[model samples]
Target: MIFEGYHPLDKTMFQVMDEEGNIIKPEYMPDISKEQMMEMYQLMIQTREADLKALMYQRQGRMLTYAPNIGQEAAQVGSAFPLKKEDWMVPAFRELGAWLTRGAKLEMIYLYWYGNEFGSYMPEDLKILPVSVPIASHLNHAAGIAWASKLQGKDEVTITYFGDGATSQGDFHEAMNWAGVYQVPVVFLCQNNQFAISVPRGIQTSSETIAQKALAYGMPGILVDGNDIFAMYAAVKEAFDRARRGEGPTLIEAFTYRIGAHTTSDDPKRYRSDEEVEKWKKKDPIDRMKKYLMSQGILTEEENEKIIEKAGKIAEEAFKYVEASGDTVLEDIFKYHYKEMTPQLTEQLAEYKAYLMERGEA
Candidate 1:
């Protein structure tokens, strides 16, 4: 297993491909066909296009706050590609790539960012939870879902994504401890994108690596090159296999960089240096995969251009669909929280409506 070889304490990271897109560890490489690999790369392209468009929309004030998944596409897409339809994906807000991998519509993602509750409505076949914003709290929910699945003898595995800062939360420890005790089938994927919204990873915890924390919880952990899609796919595939074999949970810290700001509202220049950003840009995951695919004759310059152009159009149309959807109903905000509106909520809604009427917005 990759976890057995890449000890979290030693801090020796696993890599399947180099920054130049050459496979360094063919032994650990996944057995996916070249065509399938090309598809994964195209998915990454589609995801990047959507992310860039969403940023443009947010900047234009056409959408609400959105978490950008610019540089971490490989980590998100590779880990999610191995998941079966029955598997559950619990996402933090920035996992646009993972959501797409798990069959989420681009329009739904745009709708959610456009301030509509229907964005949270998912297809019946997909088990993805809506984007969670409260840091590491969702890990507990992932553990509980796994526990329930185990109790019912269901063959479901849960994978949850969080950032490096989330590791500092008490909920992180609590969930890990419980999952360890119960031996539930779950995978903890920490993107570890170097910073948690301007806070450096160095100050997040004293531990050398986030993956090592799994040892204390009695589960295996591995640190993989998040920029190398092959390594991410292989490591996550091994973890999911271990879970299905009833070997309990695994922790995978994908050491990648966030090339953009944490969210639309954040400013990366405030805390990080341009030199640092430029250095990591050399290790861009999407570029690495494209190089590899082109070298293998799977993608040509023209073919790649077509993919990008098509994906750009798809993203453009998805946002147009979201924009064409009329404004959300005023009652939606106060009604979904309970079976019936509470007296206080009813009064509050009335006041809000009256205020909107005064402003000609109702």
Candidate 2:
């Protein structure tokens, strides 16, 4: 197995390809079909286009604060590729590529960031949790889901995504501990994007590698090149297999970098130098994947340009659709929180509507 050779304590990432798209470890290259490879690349492109569009919308005061997943697409998309429709995905706020790969609608993503609660609603078939803004809190939710699935004798695995900073939280430890103890079929994916807002990974924890933390909880762990799609795919595919085999949780620390600000409200330049940014740009996940595809004759330069342009159009169309869906009904504000609106909420909704009617704005 792939995990047998790569230990977390090695301090070296398990990689199949280099930054220049050369397959250095051809043995570890995944068995993905060309069609799926192209789909992953397209998803990455769509993710970036959507992120850039969101940034523009936020700047123009048209959208609410959004977390961009520019540089971390490979980590998100590759890890999510192994998930079955019956499987569960619990996410932190910055996994746009993962959501897209796992069949989340682009318009839903846009609407969520547009401050609509309806955006959080996934189709019944897609077992995904809502976008959690709290750091590490959702780890517990993911663990609990896996625990329940196991208890009910269902063959389901749950995958949860969070940043490197989340490892410091008690929830992370608790979830990891519980999963390990119960041998729940869950994967803890830590997109170690080098920084947690202004704090760098070095200062976030004293451990040599985030993946190694899995050992403390009695699970297998491995570090993978987060920017290398093949590496990420191989690692997660194996992790899912182990989970399906009832071997319990595995921690995968995808060593990546966040190219944009932590969110629309923050500035990355304030804490990081342009030189460092440029250095990471050379390791762009989408670029490397495109190069690999081109080498395999699955894509050409001309076709890639067209694909990128089309992805932008898709993002634009999705956002336009979200906007065209019109504003939220004011009653939905007080109506959605409970199975039945309580008497107090009923009274407040009436009072609020009456006030709005008196002001001629209802």
Candidate 3:
């Protein structure tokens, strides 16, 4: 595992599977049951379908906003699947696959996108935090949580997910510095999807790789081919294992691509070319996994069709649930904004209700 040359980051892009669906290192494959592998594949399909359906909902003005993870399935699923139920997962905006894999309800995800804050609520047993829309702000929170867990002697690791753009944030550096100092049991997984909206990775930082930034924080950093699910799983699993063993945090840079716009509001076509998108499409994480499964005779054409059909049905059902949930109640915002409302806020709420009543819209 030695990286060589002037910039070791340039030579550390680890890949388990080649572009043509061939396994470059059979030994590096993730250690999971065949059934688990199949489930992961199905989840990847479901994630893509859900993203597409959400885009449709946005187009129809049924959803407020969405950050799609269309092409980064392997990076999300691979890292999430290895976590124990007791481990904590803190996600940035575009971690639908990780959230879903960690027991988030599809309906709740849709509801959140449709402007209802309740969708952010997770079950008491699930250790997933609400999605943070701000870039890398949650990194510090994750570090704090991990530090607290360490102090309490909790046998759990905290993993935080963010995009390549997040690496440029001051919060990222601060979190990494604190985590290193305290030896917090946290794993920072950065999904480097090449671009942060219109700004490309090159312009974001002078560093050769986001993973290399970890060295300054006194933590091990590994760069993996994010499109290769096997590599991602191996990298993350090892990182978390090390964390749970009282090792300090590890920074993993999943070098992948974003094949879609930053969000429904963004038009990536304005900055990136179709050719670049197509190039990444050929190296699609999901497609490569499916091809591998087929090569092993574990996935047949009939089975693939059934998986796609099931995913579509799930997406449709989630969409319907959100639609039926209706619009967000305007007054609920005031109630949830604070534990106790100030007199001024209470007066404003009363005035708003009165206005609605006068208009017969309440």
The candidate scoring highest on TM-score is: 2
Q: Which stretches of candidate 1 lie over 4 Å from their true place?
A: 339-344, 354-361
Expressed as tens digits, the lDDT of each residue in 1-362 for candidate 1 is 68778899999999999999899888898999997798789889999999999999899999999888888999999999999989999888889999988889999988988999878878878999877899999999999998888888889999999999999999999999999999999999999999989899999899999999999999999999998999999999999999888889999999999999988889999999999999999999999999998888888999999999999999999988889873697898899678899999999999999999999988
Return the TM-score for each candidate structure: 0.96, 0.97, 0.96
lDDT score for candidate 3 against the true structure: 0.88
Ranked by TM-score, the better of candidates 2 and 3 is 2
RMSD (Å) per prediction: 1.5, 1.2, 2.0
- Kindly state the number of residue pairs that clash in model 1: 0
What is the per-residue lDDT of model 3 for residues 1-362, given as tens digits with 9 covering 90 to 100? Answer: 31221133564687888877798887776678889889889889989999998998899988887989999999999989899988999998899999889989899999899989988889978989987989999999999999999999999999999988998889999999999999999999999999998999999999888889988998888888898888888888888888899988999889999998998889998998999999899999998999989998889989999999989899999889889975788877787667798788899999999999999988
What digit string (tens of lDDT, one per residue) describes model 2 on residues 1-362?
88889988988789998998889999988898989998999999999999999999889988998999989999999999989988999999999999999999999999999988888888979999998988999999999999999999888999999999999999999999999999999999999999999999989999999999999999999999999999999999999999989999999999999999999899888899999999999999999988888887999999999998999999999999988983677888898788899999999999998999999998
TM-score leaderboard ranking: 2, 1, 3
- Please list the C-alpha lDDT of all candidates, in the order they appear: 0.92, 0.93, 0.88
Specify the highest-lDDT model's number. 2
- In model 2, state the lDDT of residue 284: 98
